[model samples]
Target chain A: MDRTEQERLITENRRKRELRYIATFVLMAVIFAVIVVLNINTGSVKISVPEIFRVIFLRQGDKVKYDIIWSIRLPRIAMAAILGGALSLSGFLLQTFFSNPITGPFILGISSGAKMCVALSLIYYIQRFGHSSSVIMILAAFVGALLSTGFVLLLSRKIRNMSILLVGGIMVSYICSAVTDFIVTFADDSNIVNLHGWSLGSFAGSTWTDFYTALAIIGVCAVVTFLAAKPISAFQLGENYAQSMGVNIRLFRVMLILLSSVLSATVTAYAGPISFVGIAVPHLVKRSLNTAKPIIVIPATFLGGAVFCMFCDLIARTAFSPTEMNISTVTSIFGAPVVIAMILKRNGGVKQ
Target chain B: MSEYVSASGLTVGYNGRPLIRDIALSIRRGEIVTLIGPNGSGKSTILKTLTRHLAAIGGTVTIDSEDLSGITYKELAKKMAVLLTDRTRPELMTCRDVVAMGRYPYTGSLGLLTEEDQKLISDAMVMVNVLELSDRDFQNLSDGQRQRVLLARAICQEPQVIVLDEPTSFLDIRYKIELFGILKKMAIERNTTVIMSLHEIDLAEKISDKILCVKGDHIEHFGTPEEIFSTGLIGTLYDISPKAFNPLLGSVEMPAPSGEPHTFVISACGSGIPVFRALQKAGKPFAAGILYENDVDWQVAFSLAAEVVTEKPFEEISDEAMRRARELIDACEEVILCPVPVGSVNARLRELINYARNAKPCREA
Candidate 1:
């Protein structure tokens, strides 16, 4: 009402927002630490915390325990965290681009498209050279992701309604999945064994090389996305408003599509096509932070996605023990309900 | 002030195709211009081109004597702000957060608002009287409050020109008045030129310094509100019956009831509007009489009455008007006398009332 009151109210709101950001980030960090330790501690070979620390930090432990920690569990955990963060960040970018929370690499068939291409390349490279390199797989997945993104963007141009665009994405997802299945069904026995596991979506068999490659690609993308937070924030208001605020809409859109595709492509290349982590993690992080300001939501979503996927990965490994469930199964079990709740809330709130 | 914004032979539309062409406009600094047209008449297309949301199909626009297309978007952002018709449902954003976005052109790469930016944000919010709502979630605010917050967002941009596309579409009458009051103050005090399209021509007539009539493939008319409204161009612009719109009063009335007159009403001095409306609503054709041309009652009667016997302002009722009134009273089945003052200049209305009482079944309204 008055000048002093108005200033006080705004300052209070800002302070409250700061507190929310701090709390959400801190909670995510704590959960991330716990999940990392749990992922290390509760594998098939029971390694104690002290021994896990010695193997990780002191680099002196029994040969078998050290090998499991350094070679197997650590890379898998790092891959899950990095890929999870990348997947969620990719989803956040897509949601910002589409202005719809329901959209993500998975929902828009981007991940499925990557999966289809990776499947084809896997069979082709394995048949020709007896093995598929991670670089080749990533390149193939990136192309496939871009192809799917291009189709979605084309459909989005003709269909202004988000629901219709989503339906179109689902159709694309189905078509790509059918193609991947067709490839997998006729592959060599050894290729089928590999392609079937990858197609089902898992974070297993991730090596330090895979981890470092994902880290390099996703790390660059995350920094670029963070730097572009200003435009992304403007974009949340809608395309016209963003353009009015000095954002080159054409360039900004290209950047969004490329970044989102690359991030999702990296995840799909390494982890296969994981579902719902992209959509669900960003939604949860924004709801927890109580804001969608990209500067805050970007890093927070990455952290939140890391925690979510690491925890899901731990469960996938330990839930059934030896008979490891696909990471997608765990992520879907936890992530799908959040997406459903979000949809219900959106529908009810829009009605009001 | 000189022309702050000028467009000559500008053509605007979507996808390289032109919808409206050859629009020439020159507006001074601190002026408010409004575009009025029917639905899908290219009002938004013209505004979009000016805001650079859409590329111009032809011609050029200049701001402060600089070719509009020559300026970078960032430089243009400092000079122009827009409030579009698109509904933005930003998630988890407070009204203050939404308003703070206006400082995008001024803020650093990360868009952290400095203290001065904060002050301007507060000032803008205070200017629009949304300071109290600064803490409310933007998506939860009512339409009126959302529009004000968005106006606050535009104001904080500190632009030389503010372009809005139908900014008052979702607002009610009270919010409409408040929003325009803020725009007028900004135009006068801050020297911010305001360009917006409006569906409400009455408000546009009252608020705008210049009115651009958009229709068909070109600007139908562009001039001061006096020049535009005085010539009854709004009726032709919207394609409504000329009699339905009263240019003098800047209000519209429903079509008059059809068929022969069944009732005659005698009233003046703003007393006969209610009676005329009642007869019109009952779908009975009515004749109203002996009112001066400049009277408020005459405006309503002209629009809603089947026939009206009128006299010039501030004169005695002429014999010709009285004769016409008498003839109307004779033809009607009944006559109603509204409470009118007995002024000496127009006291002949007492004779008409007496004549009507003697000739027909008369009643007081």
Candidate 2:
């Protein structure tokens, strides 16, 4: 092709990709608005839509309605959106780190590892040492995440095939869960009532302080990850290209693991272990945007994860109304199908 | 030309142990240097070490008179670019994005491409003829297109020197020629020094100003392609029989059909090459003769024929050569004459052709 023709072709293609990115972002924003309104309005009180808005913006309305919206639903929604975004972003980072498409905290047993540590601290440490703060739990979870990540990395050196390595991760998840179950089964009865539902996973009953702590951690880590988009983009081309492009691969890798660990640990500390959001949300966001330029996909994935978890959290609360489903159960119901479809579509693409 | 990159005692291997030792090479600015050796003979090890992807066990590499190890990675990246055989399947990255990554060293901390960086990326893609693929998904491209895209990425780095390991491994003949053309242009017009490993000896011989033959424990030979090709060096480097390589042709051939002569072929010029191969494929030993030694047919005849009657290059077909040809024709079961033009010096081959017609018919069943 001639120079002008080539230039025109490139500009046109870029325009189309830009259009897709805008459309995807607009769609995410629209979903965020809809889910935020639905989560507040539909929670059994049947408060009029205007009253819900008045309670939120003007701090006016029925006293009971004001109390419920401000204390219960708002914190729950905030936790769902923020922690969900964190989980998906964590998954995206882990996938990039491992160079495997199916990789995520949930799929690779990282969340379960965090859960095991959280459960251990709650059952053993908190029982004897009195109640602990969110930061302490996050620390325990972070350490547990690093330990499992180390095991997976060591196993990765021995097993090059991804399916087998994933099986290895599943084994780790099972072992961790079994130990957590044993601990829960034998723990004190008074705490079990509170702990069983939390360990089973839920976004409900989160306090404002817990939300703020998670917000502080996830918010800061997310910005750092977004800024690291350049290195992440280079990393997608594999380590050699990233290194050749002046990325310090050893330092970059350490940062990726730590950042992903922090994000997943924050989620586990507050909301317990959630499944499939990490893998499914990022996959869906990338497919919708039709690009994985970390610059665009980082925020797009966060928005997508927020939308996804809010929808899942809504169902977890109201799917049986007054009898809440575990957040994992609700997430697995929605997210696992996306994961399955992704794997099948990927395999089919390879065949074609 | 001034020396652009030089390495001495560049010991290299895996895990701090030397696989190939005591290497010394100096490459001139604006020169294309290629490393040629058998697989697993340390060609890639040398390249990886030079590129710093694999650490060298000993010695130093100097580029523009600065020690490679002394330079910071960020600074070194500005001076050198590399295209490795890394199987990268980046998710949803455009071909443009892949190529634009070459500007990493020049871009700001966030790697956002400046207007100038964008122009360089476009120029590099256009250079390698991948301009139209700018927005196409990188993972969806064919191996040849990906190789060209990667070359564009390297070119956009604007490095003084480029290092590639087996860049043409996945390319078809068209892309292979195109890659060489781009490298040649880079070396001449742009004055960028090129160092790479190539498995194609024919291509290596034609394209390289300097050739490094890597094998065994040390550097086997290092010189211009002419010097390297003349010494029958490639066969030793690859551990093949010397006869397997035709240095004059800059290509290799299989071991010739052995045993007694089955067919007597009368041919000259370039006509006998196909006939020689046909006989060899049929598992029939053949005798060819009565041609001037300087004829192109002499090479194939000597390589394939069980017995060859010939004269030296530029020499007349002597009477003694004709007698030997007649004897071989009598021994052979059949004779096939390739269409070769008869001239004053090779007029004796016409006599042998006549004798084959009159003699007892011994055509193979």
Off by over 4 Å in 2: B360-365
List candidate 1 segments past 4 Å from native: none
- TM-score (C-alpha) between model 2 and the true structure: 0.96
Q: Quote each prediction's TM-score.
A: 0.97, 0.96
Give a tens-digit lDDT track for model 1, residues A90-164.
Answer: 999999999999989999999999999999999999999998899999999999999999999999889988888
Candidate 2: Cα lDDT at A340: 95
In candidate 1, how many Å is residue A336 off? 1.4
TM-score of chain A of each: 0.98, 0.97
Compose the digit string of candidate 2's lDDT tens values, residues B100-143: 99998888877888778878999999899999888889999999
Candidate 2 residue-wise lDDT at B351 = 74
TM-score of chain B of each: 0.97, 0.96
Displacement of residue A97 (Cα, Å) in model 2 is 1.0
